[model samples]
Target: MTIDSPSLAPAPPAPPGDTAVHPTPARTPSAAPERLSTRAKLVLFVLCAAQFMIALDFSILNVALPVLGKDLGMGQADLQWAVTAFALPSGGFLLLFGRIADLYGRRKLFLTGLGVFAVASVLAALAWDPASFLAGRALQGLGAAIIVPTGMSLLTTTFPEGPQRERALGISGTLLSLGFTIGMVLGGAMTDTVGWRSTMGLLAVAGALVLLAAPKLLSESRHPQRPRIDVPGAITVTGALLSLIYGLSTAAQQGFGSLDVIVTLVAGVLLLAAFIAVESRSAQPLVSLKMLRRRSVAWGNLGGIATFSMMSTVVFLLTLYLQEVLKLSALQTGLIFGVQGALSAVAGVLAPKVIGRFGARNTLVGALLLQAVFTASLLGLGVASGAWLALVGVSVASVGHLGAIISYGVIATSGLPDDEQGLATGLVTSSQQVGITIGIPLLSALASAHVAVLRDGGDGFAASTLGGIKLGLGVDAAVVAVVAVLVAFGLSRRADGGVAVGGRTGGV
Candidate 1:
């Protein structure tokens, strides 16, 4: 084990039976002292920058969608496509590309993703019509799908597990959240001042800069046993995710009553079943069912999806409340999220320490509970004047949100070996992307359905909207609360007093 800085030193070897599900690369100690070089630090910067750009694109177009639709002479369904196109490929292809990176080369995949993202951004910026713009967005989503899992695998492979990996993930998670908030602010400001195209231009520049630096800084890493592609598993899973995301995204805009939504959803479920069966029997499965059976991977992903979904849904609801109910300007709503972003930064910085002290399982459950409490507190909000409540609830809940984000990553990836790092991080990023994609649609649909009922009962528009928002918040809180309990039980202490998750004295 190479001891770099104190922070970079790898943890002591796990006891027998605690290694990994797959064969791990041997971790032999180096004779000489090893320090994380300036080049390695620069590499981390580039990786994080790429992740920041990915997160930025997720939220940046949201505020500018109306402007974009008007400029392109597009209607409501077309606008929905703008968002859905990006989400479809991004959420669908994560697991496939992640396994590919491990089989081929992470550095090669990372560079390819950055190039694709930069070019896609330029294409979107220069789009002349809805067809061109949707094409660009869909390509950008593919780029994002490749970038996130590859970059994360690179990060994990570079930094040995322990304080070093935790710290690096903290910085990356911080920038990720900050990027989303900053994009919201920048999207509104740039759209009003310059043009909506500038948002795409900004991503283009970021991607280009990161791409330029990454070639030199990144080292090639891949699994030792390069297995054949799991073609059947890949096709089934990818098709399943695309269908599911489309069904859910469509249901958010239109109700679930649509034939397309119903058909696609059923298709998605059927494909998912097929994928599971394929993976179970494949010689080299795209995803290992045994790995998924790991306590850490299973519960950690559960917490991750829950936290991400609920927090994003809360933000979306508040965005509606701010704009439609209180009639705040987009810029004003962005600024409010800006404050939450700032608080999130603080939380991110502190997350590693919180995990270190409380253990990842405890920290995850606690964070979810904190998030639930603060989210439920938003019930105090009214249609007339509850701007402060929105600001306060979101800001406070964001701390737990960030904490959960970091802790879940730590838990999910902690016990995994180098060969499987890509697959493990794939699961983590999948949780994130799938969460963000589904959260708003699922909760918003419920809210919309409720609002229709309220309106039918003779409630005013403002009252109906408020009632819907409250219902969403309540469900969000309830979901998080329940998941927190499940995670607590799922990752509970083992008979020997060791953690059941990470296969160590304590998980993470």
Candidate 2:
């Protein structure tokens, strides 16, 4: 095996059952190295930078949407695509690309994804029309599909599994959260002062820098016995995800009555079912159906969906309340979100310690419960409710979000062998993107349904909107409560005197 390597993957756990899940990939000696070299640190920095870039792109557009629409002469009715385009590919293609990264070189794929992302950013920035801009966003989503899974697989492979890997993942997680916060704060300021285009342009510049450094700093790694790509599996799964998410997103705007939405949603379900059938029969499947049977991988992903989905729904509703009801400026809205972001950053750092004490399942359950409680607290919001209440509630919930991120990630990825790390990361990443993509639209529909009744009762537009929003929060809280129970009961007792999920005891 190659030595003195610059792998981005975290070293796996101690191999269990004769599996090579935790290989150091020619890096660390059998014993821990006394220290990492400067080159190793640089390589890590580049990887984190790539992660930060992906996360940044996800949030930067949040505050800029209104102005971007206005400047391009786009109608409000047609503007959702700017966000949907990115979501469709990012959430859609993750599994396919994760396998591709394993077949191709991680370093090469990482660099290529960055290049595509950068070029797409330029297209978005220079776009003079909605079509071109949506196209650009779609391409960005494709790059995200490539970047996220590979970046995660690299980080896992690069670091040693114990404290070293924990610390590295913590830092990487912090950067990812920081990117979201930074984007919001920066989006508001840049959109107000420079132009919304600056946000896209900024991504291009950041992506370019990461692309340049990655090839020089990061080493390539792949499976020893190469596996064939599963094309049918890829097409079916991506199509399913994109179609489902698109259908739901359309519901937020056009309601559930649209024929297009119904057709797509039904197609998505059918396609997902088909993908499962294809996977079961394929000699070389894109995703081994057996992986989903791993309780930890399965339940942890469900928990991840809960984490991102609820948080995103809360943010979306709060943004609407802040801007539309209270008439806050984009800058104010960004700053408000920035506070939660800062708290989220702090939580990210402490998440590892929290998990150690609580255990993974308990941590996830508690976090979800906390998020549910805080989200439900927003149900009391009204004209009398100050922005400070919103801030405190959102901030507190973000702390739970931190725990959810750490626990769910560890639960899903731990104990997996090296060859399957890409697949694991892809699944985890897809849950997150899907959660973000569908959360807003689905919740909005719930809110709208409630609002409709309030309007019938003679409430003003603002009051009806608020009433509808609170109902949505109540439902969101209920979801967390139910999932928390599911997470608690999901594990079976293991032989090693530990709770077993993914059929592993004591994490490989």
Candidate 3:
């Protein structure tokens, strides 16, 4: 399920005398040949381990949330913050950290992030109150922000583009998808057997283990030349992302009509406008406008964001439907997803071969369509006996979900040169992190709003909840189907025009 880097229209050469501005340079895979040594395998292992840990944190707390809230004396209003606090920094800081990692060093950032995450996990595990727990979660998010981009850049740079890179990414994607599912299962088991705090403690141990292994296996990677930070672009985009994620997260729990949500969302929009303006004028932009315009980067990212957002939302809603509406225990819900995880891993392993035959763009589109079809089938989910449908629909859809995940990464990072690897990986990772953070909230808001309306219309709690969930699932299906068409047409346009991929011009 990786992307075939399709031919792209090359950027016009920068003005001959414009040395200060850094244009999007051509990719240089020759700079680092593909490595198949045992050491290379170790590097991949360590990097994937770091990635798995980050993905696990995203969902590990979810199954344990109820136990955690009661133990920490948190109200329903406060419980969401435990998740939002982590998400805000994790999603918000990714692009900024990606650029910084390029300016500084990916290896350095990787180790530093690991240390920060491990320490934060320990603090969270030992927390005595809500405030202390939240502080730890925020730090964990920051650490994840640092780790994701840097780790991805390291993987892309270390494995030269081609079959080797594709296979490596396939493994990475498998672990990432598996990590989320495993987290839910592990969270439930640990919460029931020991305590919710055990989940945090497990992460702490994982962080420490990966941290110790990383330094020996990872080499420092950064831009060949050190450019000054794009301070204005940095400030505006960071502010914008932080504001936007906060607004959405708040809306998830409180509804979007609140004054607090309105103001924050407006500020986010303004700051985002400022960021665009700043980058347009900067000599060294935080993100190259030219790169953003590339079909592979733009459309690839759109597909990436859409797939992750919709798939994660599907999983989240199913978790609710299974546990709340069906009255299934947490462990029972986890077992269903555990099966989904196994199928996802199989799909991940097969993705590279599928990409080789069908091409990344086609694979991406087909995968999304498949995901849409299966997701839509979940509309058959009923109040009494539809748990089987949830299990089948999600598991089968995940086969496509895993393909989309791997293909989008390849498409996004395939064409960029070595120096911009960090930024490219950042964009890829940002799409993913942002997708994960926002999806649950956005759709949850929709479902909740529907439930409120149904309740006001005199529907019982059970009926109203079911109606809201069905509405959400329907929208999710339509959104994925739309994105599939968009990505298909978008990439087809580029192929017809003859675009550059790996310094060669041809069709995808």
Candidate 4:
């Protein structure tokens, strides 16, 4: 099931007219090397900006969901779809886009994806109804699927390994955290004052600026050997992920035992199995299965899934508590959440230094443990608790969670080679998206079940809801605790350098 490096394969000759655009044979990796210049720095900035836009879109819409629902006459189900539609495609299509980038040129794919994303944002802003808006969101997700991996590949290929790549990755990771925070603040303000549509328009402008700067700043990478597209493998995998995410989204509305949920889950599992089989036999697989054999990649992705699942659930539940329980205005709630977001940005900046000092595995384990403790404390806050206490708990928990997230990114990407960095990035990002997709339903179900128990014991709606929320947070804390233990044990078993097979160690 392993996909070997395509660099080991023979390359096709370039067409005569393509010579000018393509790198000359003398400048190839096999010949004289060219170092990235100052111009490349500008290109890296543009690429990072595009990455920020894509990441921001994921969280930005959360604060605007109510406004969008009201304006478009969207019901609960439709509102959920508006969010899920974007995430499903973004996660499902990442591997496909990563493979496409490898086959074509990274720079070409990055710019193309950014252009498509910008256009999609414009369509999203112009939508007059739920269906049209959801359609636009889905298209934007497809564009993100292309933009993310290609951007990562461009950074990896452009910057030489060592201080340069480390600095680039650090900046890239920081921007991602910054985007998530800014999305909340901007989404809330725009939805309140200008309208949700204006928020999408802002994204469009950001994307356009990135596109304009890309050409002048970026240079094309040396094309890899001609690689065949793994169409069947891609289809199967994408289908599997879509089915799984759809099933989870459906479970949020329909109980898990429903026939539709069962069918979709079963079908998804079957399709994913088929995808694995196809990859094993395909000449050029979309995903390198052998990469999973690396303990760091596997365990790091696992930790990422758990970490994001907790994070997504916490954010959702906290927002609900702030608005419903505490009766905060959207703007006030956004400002409150902004505090955590700001702290998260700080955490992202400090995470690498913490990891370098303590080691990635140890840092991850510590962060997760701190997250679990803070999450459990937050769960202890009853409806009657002081507002300040709730705010303090959330802010502290967020800081811990942010550190855990950055550590997970460092752990997952640290071990991969330049060529395989895209694969690692795609897999880890997909895992995080899957976590977010599943978090809502899974936590909601747990909370609902707790509410049922409390109601049976004569609790009222308010009491039952608070109890349910607490129970859900408790469940998330337990999950994070398990992940922490697993990470600690896994790291302890690794070699002295903490390098897993097929992965490097040193940066974070």
Candidate 5:
């Protein structure tokens, strides 16, 4: 499994999924390699811009949902589809495209994805109906699926492992995390001030500028062997992920007990089974099943699933609590998260120091424990108590979430040589996009079920809705808490066996 470094293309940046916190390992920026040339700086800047563009769209549409619904005469059930449509394709297609990027050229794929995203942005901006908008959104997701993996591949290949790459990755990771907050706030402000279309227009403008500059700034790079596309592996994995995400989201609607949910989930599982079979046999597999045996890769992906799924759930549900329940303006909701986002970025900035002092495992354990506490506090949330409690809890909770992100990224990609970095990053990215794809809808469904129960008992719509939200938050907190314990235990076992993980002391 050892990959000889063959002067692959400079790594672009961690794709959107691995972009949980910082791509930089747990090292100080001052420890980074000396004298980054002007061109190196440009490479970093261009890739970061692409990362921000793709990441921004993930949340940009979140705040615009209300306005989009109003403009297109859509309902709550359908409004969620806009988010899912983008997430499913984006998350599902990543491995397929990541492999493709490596085989053909990362630069080519990156540029193409950017152009596709730009065109998709324009399509979304000009959409006059729900179908058109959804179509555009899906295309954008496809573009992101391609762009993120290629971008990250470019990054790892560009800089050799150690301080220089860590610094570069930190920039990439920070920007990736920044997208969610920025999108929520920016989407809200634009939707409120101009229109939902303006939000789409903004992406179009940004994508256009990057699309033009990428070729000039980036040199082409690819895997040295130019491995053949693992078509069966690609098909099966993409199908499994898309089906799984779709099933998870559908379960939120039909309930886990519903026949469709059961059938769809079974199909997803079967597809994944098929994917494992295919990957095990393929010479050039899309995903190396053996990689999962590595402690850092396996456990790190688990941590990623927890951190991303749980944190994103908080944002999605909290936004509902603020706007749908409290009847706050989009701009107000945006401003709150804007502040939270800035705070989260600051937390990310401090990650190296935090990891240095606490060690990676401790950083994650503490962060996740605190996350559990803050998220649990939301269970006590009710509109009657005012927005302050929810705001403060979620805002502070995000800092802990920020730490988990950094630790997970460090864990997932740590100790890997350059050639395998793509596969490692691809897995991390998949975990993230899948987390985002499923978390909101999963909680949304729980919220709906709670509302249904309360309404059946003759509760008011407002009361039932609030009840549902709190219950969902309760569930979210429990999941994160459990993950915290499991990760700590697993990492502890690994550490006892003398494998450093999640910090300078270990593999991470």
Candidate 6:
């Protein structure tokens, strides 16, 4: 039978015996049929809402950082921690949580994650000190770590591969970009008028709504012979990721040579190495090592990491420049950034069509190259370059970045079996988050260092600061270009057929 929703059709049934192995129950017959029904739309709504909530959290707090820093008596470094706290766990625990969803049920994990996220947001709103706020944010991250991947898995499973799925994915991508834009604007408004606490309160309310709607819409996947949760694998991997992210984030502030930084870095490396070894041997590893062996997955993940790193760092630095250097009000800064978000949303909506025409690999390579060009263009403009020019470059870059992201999303999931979809999606999404966490600090530090050097050479703080931002953007552009080149040659070996990497076809 043909599934109506493009998102829900065209996927071959799970390999014969696999269904017996993972016997997810169909949604209640009284509610809606699995094939296609009005009930499925409700399911999609809940999933999209959850995904949007998670996406909003990533960018919403950007506008609140200044206010949060002041209220909690935090300095610059402490403020960075607020963002890092959320990003680190959100990225670090993705793989573990994805595996849990597969072993358990996506609907179960998603609702549970929403509950945790809501509680965490409430705690964040009431926090009286930096430590408490940071803790709350960390918990929020943990919740998001579970919510995002599980939600994606649900979409992948619910929809079949076709126009319906493609359209749904496109809409989902648009919603994500829109959420980021809305978050920035909402965050600024809340921070300026109601206070920073209101921002967290907003997330809490949204999360609660998602929790309420989830039960009605979502169906639990069956797992007749549920695989045992790999506790050791989860622990080692989580620890390793946390340590590595913390170390990388800390390096921005304390320098890589700091004893604490060195210790964390070493510990993270060792733990990660140990985790890989364990996965290679485990009967049911959290992440299939065999998946990583695929060239498509490996290179696609690397490209995702590099692309998101550039995008996140650009957003961070530009926000700072708009506020501190250009002296724009919070509202104005939000408005300016909103333009970029709008362009990205538009690009996301159009991305599927572009991919269909050009093919995924070609579209991805072109988008990345365009992104690099736009990023480099930003380096050529300054305060004297005119506001219109700056805005144009920013919008162009935003469009390209969004296009690249959508392309990657489609390309990465192509040809994967249903069972592996959750884990693979989680890994790729985690790479993006990890890139953001690592990118912000590293790029910020680069800008700061460059500013110091220029100041020492007699340029005033303002001039030096802008100069530093220019240099940092240049570096970001270069990195993106390099990654695009790698994808073009290494990952895009076969155009007509699916991408092949490491002798595997589907994983990429």
Model 6 spans > 4 angstroms off: 1-38, 222-224, 494-508
The candidate with the higher TM-score, 4 or 6, is 6
TM-score-wise, the better of 4 and 5 is: 5
- lDDT, candidate 3, at 422: 92
lDDT of all predictions = 0.86, 0.78, 0.85, 0.73, 0.77, 0.75
Q: Name the lDDT value of residue 274 in candidate 1.
A: 99
lDDT of 4 by residue, 270-378 (tens): 9999999998888778887766655567777787788788877887787777777767787877787778777777776676566545556666788888888888888
Clashing pairs in 3: 1-351, 1-352, 4-360, 7-499, 7-500, 8-499, 8-500, 9-499
TM-scores for every candidate against the unseen true structure: 0.93, 0.91, 0.92, 0.87, 0.88, 0.88
* Candidate 2 error regions (>4 Å): 1-40, 492-508
lDDT at position 144, candidate 2: 89
lDDT, residue 383, candidate 4:
70
**Top model number, lDDT:** 1
lDDT of 6: 0.75
Q: List candidate 1 stretches off by more than 4 Å.
A: 1-37, 493-507
Backbone atom clashes (below 3 Å) for every candidate = 2, 15, 8, 1, 17, 16
Q: Rank the candidates by TM-score, best first.
A: 1, 3, 2, 6, 5, 4
> Residues 1-508, candidate 5, lDDT per residue (tens digit)?
2112233333333212111122233322122333476778888888889989988998888767877998988898898788778888898898888778767777888899999999999999999888998999999999999888888878766755534555565567678878988988888778878999999999999999998888887887767788778888888889888888878877776688988878878988999999998888888788877667666677778887887888898888888888888898777887788777787878777764565455566677788888889999877777665578877888888888878877676667765555566777778788888877778778888788879999999998778988998888888899888988887777666332335323342224
lDDT of 1: 0.86
Instruction: Report the number of backbone clashes for model 6.
Output: 16
Query: RMSD of candidate 1 to the true fold?
Result: 3.6
Q: Any idea how many clashes model 5 has? A: 17
Name the weakest run of 10 consecutive residues (lDDT summed) in model 2.
18-27
lDDT of 2 at 9: 45
Model 6, 322-358: lDDT tens digits are 7666777778777777888788888887876665455
Q: Could you tell me the lDDT of residue 170 within candidate 6? A: 66
Residue ranges of candidate 5 with Cα displaced over 4 Å: 1-37, 73-76, 257-260, 494-507
